[model samples]
Target: MTLTLDGEKIDRNRFTGAKVENATFHNCDFSGADLTGSEFIGCTFYDRDSRLGCRFSRAQLKDASFKSCDLSMTDFRNVSALSIEIRECRAQGADFRGASFMNMITSRSWFCSAYITKSNLSYANFSKVVLEKCELWENRWNGAQILGANFSGSDLSGGEFASFDWRAADFTHCDLTNSELGELDVRNVDLQGVKLDSEQASQLMERLGILVIG
Candidate 1:
């Protein structure tokens, strides 16, 4: 029986190491709150404009709208936020290892140089995000909307980008070694300074109706 504090602004509260269950925070703000090492199992935090550095390390924010928040440099390692919408936030250098947030909507955010390895982000809409110099290895991006996103200088090795609508995406100077691009349509995507393998280039060409005949 968790308290339904929906659409409320909770500031400077100590939620550290507390297990909150079935709490839905719609259009709420957690400004200056310390949620470090807390277990928010089956809780939702939506519309949080965190400007005072709220911490969220090893927290379980599963199956919720964790949206509209600025979680810059927040410890997001080992968090289970399945189908979460982490939109319009600044999460630079955040570690998302072993985090499962599939079909997420992460648009208009700045995730520059974030360490995101072994994560599941299938069918996600990552539009207009600054992902420059990011270490995105071994992540799932199947059927994702990577439109208008920037992957410049990002090491996207061993990542999957199959069947993604990548029109208007920028992959400048990105490393794509052993990346799964089986059905990636790159017709309107930008490849000005991209660095991919020969087979990967051929796959992109094939998707653009260009047959490679020896």
Candidate 2:
């Protein structure tokens, strides 16, 4: 059940349980289509235009560019996406668990309620993005620029965030247990109502030049 969409324009179509594995879509357009429950394992989407509910589980999107489209609720679990550009898209409720994103630019996108566990986001720029209530546990975010982003009520436990820029970001009521914070800068970022241990809070405050008197 494999479908190959090469240089095709498929607009407003509903494709469910469609197997699109090992296919190559060159300059294809799938705007406003409902591709829920679709599997796209080992597929290549070069300069494709896909939008809204395009689910892809265990897919390998290597060298793909989903630039400037609405790709909400798109499942990317266990997907290997190298050099992908998902900039300025609505990617809410998209599951990216166990995915590796290398040199990817997913800036200014909405990732509300998205599950992104065990993903590699090193050197990726999620600047000015809205990530409300998203699950990002055990992920690596080293050298990533996440300024002015909203991460309210998100679970970021056991993640690696060494030397990242998180200025003006909100972490209200978020969980950050057992996460790596080696030399992280928390200046101008709100830390109220955040779930952290005393040692973690003290270490974070000490980095912010706050002297604790007993």
Candidate 3:
């Protein structure tokens, strides 16, 4: 029996550097709250009964981390998430639309950062999100909605991309070695500066009907 703390209103609160576990925050408003350096483990933010998810929209999540958490169908829209880490978490169908991971220095000058490794991101909405130069390796991206998303210079190595569309997002300058490039057509998607292992390259060549000799 998993005991859960439900319907807790922690919005606009400063829970910086705090650690929470096994808590259910269904429909809870965490908007504009400071959760920097906090860690959440085995926590659930989605309510299956009402199909509602907790709101982390516009939250300060810099360096905030989550591990083994069920964040399915959660709202993370427009959050400032620089250096946010999510490891081994079940974030299926979570919304990350409009989330900013970049630190702007001046006009046309900025750098992005985030460590989202080993998480399940299947069917998650990242449409039009900019995640350039971030650490996003080893995640399961099956059926993720990444239309018009920019992932340039990001490390996406060792990821599982079954049923993923490479043409829907930008993968230029990305390290995609040892990843399953499902349906990734080399002729359709731009692969400039994209790194792939020899085996993956050969597999892609086979898809284009090109006979890879040796």
Name the best candidate (by TM-score). 3
Stretches of model 1 off by over 4 angstroms after superposition: 1-111, 185-187, 202-214
| Best first by TM-score, ranked | 3, 2, 1
**Pairs that clash in candidate 2:** none
**Model 2 lDDT per residue over 17-41, tens place:** 3555456555455543445444445
- Give all TM-scores, in the order shown: 0.49, 0.53, 0.93
Q: Which residue pairs clash in candidate 1?
A: 173-193
RMSD to truth, every model: 11.0, 11.0, 1.8
Error of 1 at 194 (Å): 1.7
Error of 3 at 134 (Å): 1.1
- Give, for candidate 3, the lowest lDDT window spanning 10 residues: 1-10
TM-score of 3: 0.93
Instruction: Report the candidate with higher TM-score, 1 versus 3.
Output: 3
Q: What is the lDDT of residue 76 in candidate 1?
A: 49
Instruction: Report lDDT (Cα) of residue 174, candidate 1.
Output: 81
| Candidate 3 lDDT over residue span 1-214, tens digit each | 5546567668565467888878677777788889988889888888989887788999999989988888888899999999998998888999999899989999899999999999999999999999999999999999999999999999999999988989989999999999988889899999999999999999999988987888
What's the true lDDT of residue 17 in model 3? 84
Clashes (candidate 3): 0
Give the alpha-carbon lDDT of every model: 0.55, 0.57, 0.89
Error of 1 at 112 (Å): 2.9
